[model samples]
Each structure stands twice: as structure tokens, then as C-alpha cells.
Target: MTIVLTFMPFAVGIMDNDLRQLLAQVARGDRTAFAKLYDVVSGRLFGIIGRILPRAELAEDALQETFMRIWQRASSYDETIASPMAWMATIARNQAIDLKRRSAERLAALASELDETLADESPDPESLAGQAGDLRRLGECMQGLPNERQQLVLLAYRQGFTREELAERFKRPVTTIKTLLRRSLIALKECLDGAR
Candidate 1:
């Protein structure tokens, strides 16, 4: 009789452990461990970027850039303030912002490509409103909140505007936008939960 026993090291803090250790191993030139870590975290990492960027093409680009940074900066992550994934989150966020900026620049350059006859007119509001049912649903929920909170949510999600971007757009301090978005998201979550 032949018997086989399977051992899962991660279950007891081996393979399934937090990212800091995997990153440390990566820093030491361990490619195998890095591959494993990538397989484990890529889904959640993609989800975070997808929520912020929305476009599949942009999200995919950010995802690739994010993993590349993880391999390069694995040694620089500070474990005191946050975990390795938090560091990865920051990198992913920056990549998404870069992608958005590039896309905006490209769109600006292509503005003249539209024919003047078509460009002079605006789309019908009813058609737009009908197509924006999803946005309207979310907007309805947001409109129920205070004015400040509603604006913060809109600036963050609608325009893919980061706190720093919102600060610059609003001609306010970065700290103000940060505080507003943080508080607004928390309040919105609570309101959503109460409805549930």
C-alpha cells in the first residue's frame, strides 16, 4: 500500500503568510516566491484598481505596472505604517493615476479629430439621462447626503480625481480634500449599511 500526505505550509504561516515576508524573499532575489505572491494578491490588487479606474484597459495597464513596482521596490516597503499589500496599494493607485493622465492627454490631442458639424452640437439630455441610469442610482444615494459629502464623492469617483487632484481642482489644500473624502466615504458606507 502506498500513502501520500499533503502539507500546506502557508496555513500555519508558511506559504499563506503576509506579503512582507514574500517581499523580503523577493528582495533577496527569490523569483519563485515572488511569483507565488503575485498569484495570491493579483486578484485583490486588480479589484482595488478597477474600483478606482473602471476601464478594463487602464486597469490592466495599472496592474502590470503595479507588479513591476512590487518586484523593484520590494525592499523599500515600510512595515511599520502598513503591510506589504498596503504599499502595493499605493503603487497601484499611482499607476492608475499615471494611466488616467496619459489617457487625458491623448484625448486632448485627438479633440480636433471630430468634425465641426458634429462637434458644434451637444447630445440630448434625455438620451444621456436614460443611459446614465447607473450613475443616477448612485447619484440619488449621494444626493441624500450633505452637500460637502456629495461633492467629495463625485469628485473622487466621477473624474477619477485623487484627493490631491481634487484639492488642486477645487483650489483648496490637499489635507482638506483628504479629510472630506475619508469622512464622506465612511458616512456613505454607514448609510448604505443602514439601508441593507
Candidate 2:
């Protein structure tokens, strides 16, 4: 089967009535409407994923997952509560966050396995001393952040809390948590660079 996708001009202050209609049609299992909906909002959704995910390939993967979720969940979407774009953006954000959380969990698992394997391996005294100094430097840098930011950074990075989980624990929006993390990372980078 051949599919043709159509693109519609979208701009700020432009109502997404057409997009909303397309989504409604897609919910009825209309493949042509799905293709048109993809063409209409895929760029914006991809940009959202790209901003959230560090790697291009991961962002692309997240975008694909976002669309898959959109296709699966179209019938559950409520037009009264959110615009089509907002609903789509939420799906994209969620997919990106999920991908990041899964990646972190995999890395954490690998690190834990490595640590267990290396527990009996003793390092030279010089290497131990160097590691001690680095840990001290890191502690000093972390202390420079505000208490809330310090806690957020530790919970998010060191403890492997996802942004959504941090939002729930801190009673803040996920976007706020993301912003705090970005600022905290920038501050740490500057502090570490100056200490070097």
C-alpha cells in the first residue's frame, strides 16, 4: 500500500483545529490521517526529543516511540483538557524521559556489576590518593550549590532518580527539575574547571 503525507502550515497563535480533527480521524484507524498528522507535527516533536535526549540517535528513537504511543493512545486523548499539540508534546516528552531513565538504569546496573567484580582489586597507594583528592574536589564543588540544587543533583544523577520521580518527591514540575539539573551541571562544570 502507498501512503502520501500532507504538511500543513503551523505557527504561533494558529489554532490546531485541523490537527485535532486529524487526530480524531486517526483514532478511528485512518492510516491516511495518521500520516498527515505525522507530517504536521513530527518536526516539532523531534525537536522536543532532541532537546531532552543528548544523542541524535536516541532522540530519533524517542520520536518514533512517541508516534507509536500517539497512535496507540489517540482514542484516550481528551480534546477538552488539552490541545492536540500539547497532548502530542506530552507524549514526546514522556518518551524522551523514558528513554533517558532506561539508559541511566542500564548504566547504573553495569556500574554496580563492575564495582562488585573490582571489590577485591587493590589500587596502588598513589592511585588511591589521587581518587581521594578527586572525591574531595567533587564534594567541595557540590557544596557550592544551593542546598535544594545540591539535593536535586544528587537525587537525579547519583541516586538515579528520574525527572518525573524527582518532580513527585520535590512537588515541582518535571520541567523545573530539568532546569535545576541543567543549571546545577553548568555550575559544577565551572567550579571543577576553575579547580583544575
Q: 1-196 in candidate 1: lDDT tens per residue?
A: 9899987553433433457778899888799988988898899789988987887878999999999988998888777876676778889888888888887776545433322312444568777766465445555668778887687778676666676778887887665565566566666656656654
Give one digit per residue, the lDDT tens place, for model 2 in 77-145.
Answer: 897899889999999999999999997786567546534633566688879978887778889999999
Lowest-scoring 10 consecutive residues by lDDT in candidate 2?
A: 110-119
- State the displacement of the C-alpha of residue 110, model 2, in Å, after optimal TM-score superposition: 0.9
Error (Å) of candidate 2 at residue 94 is: 1.2
lDDT of 1: 0.73
What overall lDDT goes with each candidate model? 0.73, 0.85
Candidate 2 wrong stretches, greater than 4 Å: 1-9, 12-15, 121-196
Worst 10 residues of 1 by lDDT: 111-120
Report the lDDT of model 1 for residue 33.
82
Q: In candidate 1, which residue pairs clash?
A: 10-15, 10-16
